[model samples]
Target chain A: MATGLKIKTAAELRTNYLRREMFPTIFCDGCGLGNVLNYTLWAIDEVGLDLDRTVFVSGIGCSSRLPGYINADGLHATHGRALAFASGIRAANPDLTVIVFTGDGDGAGIGGNHLLHTIRRNMDVTVILVNNFTYGMTGGQSAPTTPDGGFSSTTPYGNIEHPLDICELAKALGAPYVARWPVVSPAQPVKSIAEGIRKRGFALIEMLTPCPTAYGRRNGLKEIEQIWRWYREHTVLLDEWEWVEQFGSPEEREALRGKLKIGVFQDTERETFEDRWAALVAREKL
Target chain B: MHTIQIDEGWCKGCALCVIYCPTRALQVAARFSPRGVHPPELVRPERCNGCRLCELLCPDFAITVTEEGRVHA
Candidate 1:
């Protein structure tokens, strides 16, 4: 909450969020996912939140590797069970701010149930999902989020099915907050995710990242810069609704095939299930 | 009066100069650059030994080391 914003040296950014020593994360150059993670960590420190009170959970996928790269308390779990693990952490330590980072396949496909029930319960935890248009870890197989026309190992004939919009699903599931951002839109995404972290109840932020190594090969995008250009043209900001209000739906999402839209789509305050359950089961009340 | 010139357009935004700089005269710019990456700038000319690690390590061949005592095209 300190006043006006200003650009900082990457060195300065590393001091708090990176802790000056814990890890030197291994991520390739020009990878937007790492940049987004760095920005997210910086935003966390910007809010002056107690880092020790934070916990991170992730599932199997290339993006799942993120939780391990971060300085937070990370639990690398099985495919699609990140939400379940995070929920357990939250249920055990209600004071901690739980964050879950997973890939499109892990969160939306295998873990979709955990995602839904986690939101249905509405216990406070922030969800950060990356839709890189395909599964990156297991040799670039087709993911539930892969675009209809995009290429994947299993979709060599060109994916005929449309991609799933995780943000839309979260909103439909009655999540208190839902946002969608691209990896390149660091500033706005960082700010919106900050809001999501401060929010109570369920919050989900979907980021469209570039899998420069795997999906990039299938899509014929050799340079990370090329994929980044895709994000720059297609994505729009929340304040710039004019850029996206006209573009809606999964088919409309294709209009963003070469682009992205970043914003906080939903935000509402609600009673956390954990708090309510605790109060209800208190011995004093009985 | 001769000084090295860094071709910003060819610069790849790598840290070779920042890390290999013997005199600690260089630092990466903090602002968003035109190439959409952090560009290097000569922060302390006094510290430059003109050893040219920046010239050698430039991934894009963006930097050139020029001798102050020589005049050449």
Candidate 2:
């Protein structure tokens, strides 16, 4: 909870944070990517981050375009390499705060290796990875996080592989901050993102956003209401999930299957890459 | 009283606000905006509770809820 911070209204936030020149974003009518951007801005505002000292880094995707809309320094890096660029920025100027906006395809699929090493090294960065289940910009191809039996252009017959749980992967890698939230609910994500920004290590916030035009139309969730409802019904809070798994009946446990767990999965401090590097330099000088 | 302002230029008319409005005070306007989408209209303003859930859920930053005299310039 970011206490004592005055929460700005949408109008106030827009005037203070957004680049007005980027009016009418490129997101689809029913796409939740815009909501992700909104929640992120709220988080940034709550954290009271100095736009001049913060840098937004993103890869080649619809979600990656977010950095351009924010009135701050941004790096529109190559496909799936946003993390690489962000790492460089962090290493060179540790005083600057780096926030990376990446999509499921761009972050988890094409740049899985970079994602792994970044977390392993515990680089100081906040990653807002929007998981829309498919490659939205490239004509709705099956992404690494696309659920099994889900429909997409590349998976017309239905995807055969299991969906990747990005938050779990981050937790396994010992990320200092890890959370998953659906865009349907705004409050939790805003709070979680703020927490991620304040935490001093690798922080991963996986936002499950609706892709009505891309993923939903093919999966019988074409209507905006339907997709939003699907997200609400399919996602369970982390605490509720644990309780169900521990004490629920067989049918109850079975029903919990395939539902995404949302909430802060982990929060722990660790030695960041920048701190360790500083220590190494000091030791070498002695 | 809270007033709901809908910026037609930015609204894509997804109706997320209308659907998620706790008071059901909003409805998709029959008239389309310049963007060719039906922006939400605050039909029953009296029912609005100033919770601003619509403002928060609107994907497009098209909706703003503000107190009567405290409008942001």
Please tell me what DockQ candidate 2 reaches. Answer: 0.82
Candidate 2 Cα errors over 4 Å, as ranges: none
Docking class of 1: incorrect
Clash counts per candidate, in order, are 5, 0
Residue range A68-103, candidate 2, lDDT tens digits:
889999999999999999999999999999999999
Mark the regions of model 1 whose C-alpha exceeds 4 Å error after superposition: A1-8, A19-24, A238-260, A282-286, B1-73
True contacts kept of each: 0.00, 0.74
Worst 10 residues of 2 chain B by lDDT: B64-73
Clashing pairs in 1: A234-A259, A234-A260, A235-A260, A235-A261, A236-A261
The sequence of per-residue lDDT tens digits that candidate 2 reaches over residues B12-68 is 988999999999999999999998989999899899989888888887788999888
- TM-score list, all predictions: 0.74, 0.98
